[model samples]
Target: MANTVNIKIDGIDVSVEAGKTVLDAAKKLNIHIPTLCYHEDLCVAGNCRVCVVEQEGVNNLVASCAIPAQKGMVIHTNSHKVRNARRHVVELLLSEHNADCTKCYKNTKCELQDLASEMVINEHMFMDLVPDKNYTTDKQSPSIIKDDSKCIRCQRCVRTCHDLQHVSALGVAYKGDHMKISTFFEHPMYEVVCTNCGQCVNRCPTGALIEKNYLDEVWDAIYDEDKHVIVQTAPATRIALGEDLGMESGSIVTGKMAASLRRLGFDSVLDTDFSADLTIMEEGTELLTRLKKALVDKDTSVKLPMFTSCSPGWVKFLEHTYPDYLDNLSTCKSPQQMFGALAKTYYAEKKGLDPDKIVCVSIMPCTAKKFEANRPEMRDSGYQDVDMGLTTRELAVMIKQAGIDFQELPDEKFDSLMGESSGAAVIFGATGGVMEAALRTAYEIVTGREVPFKNLNITAVRGMEGVREANIKLENVLPAWSFLEGVELKTAVAHGLTNAHQIMEAIHKGEANYHFVEVMGCPGGCIGGGGQPIPTTPEIRRKRAEAIYREDEGMAVRKSHENPEVQQIYREFLGEPLSDKSHWLLHTHYVKRKRV
Candidate 1:
């Protein structure tokens, strides 16, 4: 019956646990408190005083997000004095912000514009400072754009780059009005150590940070009579796409998504899950091969603790921060790229179409995929394998632009070639899913038996811990994998680059003894990716993850190697996993960058 503290917000009394901020209490009562810097994923940064509220007996209004609820505390969220202070804060931010809303990418979705309209601030209460700021926009990055003119000095992006990601690519420089977020020496984002993960874009309150959208280019390609556009939808995109399309969070729209893309005039609608299963086959074999060499042949040339290379953000993080460990990363391309290559080559040959006319587009839940698609090495198919990448949010816009009634759309299946997938591929959307999927296939391949887990679910590698470890013992192995018999395969999973940094540190200090590692660049894996729906909180991520597992359980085929299409591909085109053809199409290398 008793909580740690009691507080009154706008005459409504509510009890909350200790350490709960006033903002949290207000949320419990369904009270709205406008915020620019107060993001749930980042640490408390009271830089923007937009959430200021009146406190009884206090000389100055307190920032509700930074102030913890004390016992018997009285708060007024919309008192006359509180409104005036909050208004002034917005006015100051607007004066400095490039209030050119119509020309901005985030025009209708801009939080400042909404707040300005909500407050009814029709007149310019202060002199416009945009003309004097002389801010510059950096448009060099393939994945992101950093515009200083629209920034309100909220520091949400700062906290995300530093606290959540540990990649400090953006930080505060100078002081007061002269302050601005800048990379090392203010270099262009592409030239600096920025991973182009786009976490900052997700947290930015204004148009200061945004993904470099290729929607227009993709539209042009679709309209071209010579081009045959094929779109591949990522695993995570299906579960989260509904959130922005007027559907509930965690709604599995796989069938609906396929249907929508078909209606949108795509030449072909495929599944990225097909390549996801292909990745598992290749990555799992590579892991076992490395083990055979390191254990049987005593080869020191092979790298232990082989890291998964599916996440481009994690790959770039290593390229810049831990270049020496480049060899540790698996040589397999991401599911997106693998599909891209196969689309232009295998699919092209199968369909009797020209590879040059086959344009591959991806619907992914990552901004890093945009950068990954543009990497020179991705031209493994002899052309730009992936022509463009669209985030889940971007796809939702296209669905809207086409005026399709998404909720009423019927469930449809993907096209034949490069469209089939197993349940293992579906789990790639969640953290620890890669390790779990790899084990399910590798253990069977080595031991000739299913992995010793309940209902074929390897729960060890699944959860929300920043870093997790699981050790599986291989027993009763086949002749070729006898070297792995009685060997304990140690693997670790990490989501978010900060956790990846921690895991890498442990391996560097000789504290970790893992043989395999799985790292996803975004927190909660791709479900909580930077290109997911707006306001992607912890609860939404949990929902999306649950939807993924439910989808896996509902599938008839659960293992990667058991996928009929995968077996068919190996039998008809690719001889086997890690074959010469597979290597040429499904494998690629990484670039090492000097940490600036």
Candidate 2:
């Protein structure tokens, strides 16, 4: 058994694991510790000095986060000395910070704002130190914005970018008050090697970095009576949307979410999972055709190692980071785009509705989705497939403005045909879910055998790990052909652009030899997205991931290939996958943007 240490804080006796910090032990006893620089995932950088605590036999208050707990240690978390030191830390931070919270985007939700209110520090008691500033705005990136004026220099963004993301797009430049967060040599974010994945935005405790809000555009469309608007939500939206509405992380609010949309006066509330299953049919067939073309006819240009193109961030990351691998990206458009195409064509025809008069909207948990929606090739159905895209946060505000009581609202179902989905369709919200979904269909289609593991959870590729790999055999097919003969399936899953960089480097160096790879631009897939709820932490993401799995476990049909709705769509409208109609409507091509 491991050694345990006894410690007491405020008369409570606590036994904690040896080497655990005082802060960790305090949290176990329901004690709150105010911290700024100490993030759960990143290395402990006790720079802010906000978590000072009074301990017996110590001359002064010590940083609880960095100090290890010892046997028989007595600590007072809320002593006068500790409170004074913490207040001074906050006051100093405010002395340089822009204290315009009322006009700030993070007015009600910022960590710094919450800390100030929690510690009862109303004003900057010290002399205001306005350091000479050079960097201010980072509008160069299409997906991300950086405003250094609101930065507290807590280095959370820097650590998340460099340590967790493995993308050192941000760094502390110069020294002392001259310290400022900047791109390489003070260049614009777009000019530097920034992937615009928005990991920095999610980690930022303040409004220093944020997604470009398009709530006003959506609101204008909603108010116009002449416009007939229909909204579609991605599968991941249900798991993460609750966070924006002050609910616990990872709550499954799909039913309430649909009801809320109805209250918002949308003409129809649809499910992108409906289209995600549709993607499976189209993409599954596309993969089979590509493999046949490569294996039978030796088509090296469009051959093995097909990459999933559902994530716009991954698409953009490839465009900038790995242009050579463009051919490897699947030609199929993402489910969001696929829904827009089908809605404007098939749905419009069924309802006798004019495509031009209908405004198709989407609720997404990503900022790169906005960039994807604006792409020129997205218009496959004689018009812009999706007219507008709103983040999960924006949808929450819309629900509030409509005066809908979310908690009291009755559970509702999505629209017919387009709203029906399965567990495999729902898993698209998680990391490596698309790849797993694709594999389930591809394996069965090629081998003509039911998968050995009925529940294709593939836990190896799941979670926030930087990289995950898996391999499967083909022994069930062609007994004469050995398990390793002809084909051997190998795959990898990576989330966050930084990990994508490492994978790209491996591919470039011939270090990795895999048949397929799944890459998501965000750190923890769509659940922990740039356009998700504010103050996204590792703990919150884990909760959301659990919720996603719970949803999957509760699903009737957990395999994408098993979704009857998808099979019916392919049987009714499209003849087969990679058909002439499927090619024109469901599939898409990518372009290389000039680096100006």
Candidate 3:
């Protein structure tokens, strides 16, 4: 129960929980108050003052997003004063911001530009303040570009980096007119402890923060006559790419995605879900081997609570923040890297195509995948394994550029050889999906039965909670996997770097214990990735997750081990998980980065 407060807006009566912001109360009435600094996923920062409202008897307007509604309060969200104040606020934001909208990466998608259009601000309302400052643009990072000129001093990125992520890579550096967000020592993002998660890029209302897109490079690769360009789409990507292309959130556009990629003239359009299934195989085997070493051989060097390494953002976070526990991470490369490596090696050998002519591209739901693809260790195929890492947003751009009506395109299946996937791989879009998927396979491998849950759905580990835990008792184990029957296996799942830090602290303090851990750098895992869609919210992520689980349920094959492509690959190429060749192409090491 909550203390309900009654409030009036424009003579309409509204009742909401006590201490709820005026903006929240207005939202119940469907009153759309424009905002820039405010984000549903972050702590409220009322500094922008664009969401101001006029309260009866109050001479000055209050920020609707910050002011709590009280009993009998009369609020005017669009009163003359409020409208004028909001207009002036937008004008002020534009005064300091570079209004060169056409040249910006965020162009039509920019929030400030939207506000200007709504207010009919065709010209500056005040003196141009952008000329007074010497703004700097940082394009050194492979994942993100930081341009101070486009920043509106809105602190949304600052709050997202600090409060939501607990990664304070960006901070306000100066005061008043000189105030700006800067990294420590103003070092380029690549030179800092920034994990390149792209949460800041997602929250930014302006072009100040944008993923460094490789649209031109990818277009060039597609145009090369002698090149064999192949693109792999991630599991999360199909669940959200429709949102940017005029479809509703949670729309499964797998067929449309494949068709659009083919329309764009890619040599092959594959699914990363295929390699996601592969990851489960390699990672499950690694976990079983580690358990054998720790419980059976009493190996001192074996690390328990093995962490999943599917998220490049989480991998980089661990490298910078928990360098000493690098061994705890599963050595299996992410599905993207695994597919990239195989695209050049196994696929090339099977197709009899020269590896040099093969250009491997990945359409990911993450910006960090771009940075991950560029890592020196990812070059396992001798040349750059993954030539380009395109975000879902970038893919939408290409689709729009090609003039293909995405919704009108018919659904098509992914190409053979490395495109087939299981239901378990599809759920990799959600937060706790990895833990549930792994347990679904590992528990079966030990007990020789489907997971005891209904229809192989592990509900215990499937959720939106920050840090979740589950316990499974391995019983009636197969003779080969029998270390000790009746062993209760403990596992944990955490999404978001902040929650990851909390779980890691608990593990370090010996307050909590587990045999395995799943960590995703973003709030709701890959479905809520930094590169999925702009304006992602709790509601939007929930919809995407629903789409993911629904897609999983509709699939004929629900377990990773059941995928025939995986079985064929094992039989034809790798032989088994963690083989010598698997180590050469599917796994690598991590380096401890200097802590800031």
C-alpha RMSD by candidate, in order? 1.1, 3.2, 1.0
TM-score comparison, 1 vs 2, better candidate:
1
- Residues 25-48, candidate 2: write the lDDT tens digits: 999999999988888867888888
What value of lDDT does candidate 3 attain over all alpha carbons?
A: 0.92
Query: Sort by TM-score, best first: what order?
Result: 3, 1, 2
Q: List the residue pairs that clash in candidate 1.
A: none
Candidate 1, superposed: residue stretches over 4 Å from native: 1-3
lDDT of 1 by residue, 560-589 (tens): 998888898899999999999999999998
Q: Local distance difference test, per candidate?
A: 0.92, 0.80, 0.92
Model 3 worst lDDT run, 10 consecutive residues: 158-167
Off by over 4 Å in 2: 1-15, 55-60, 70-74, 127-135, 139-142, 185-192, 455-460, 463-465, 475-486, 561-565, 568-573, 591-596
Report the C-alpha displacement of residue 559, candidate 2, in angstroms: 4.0
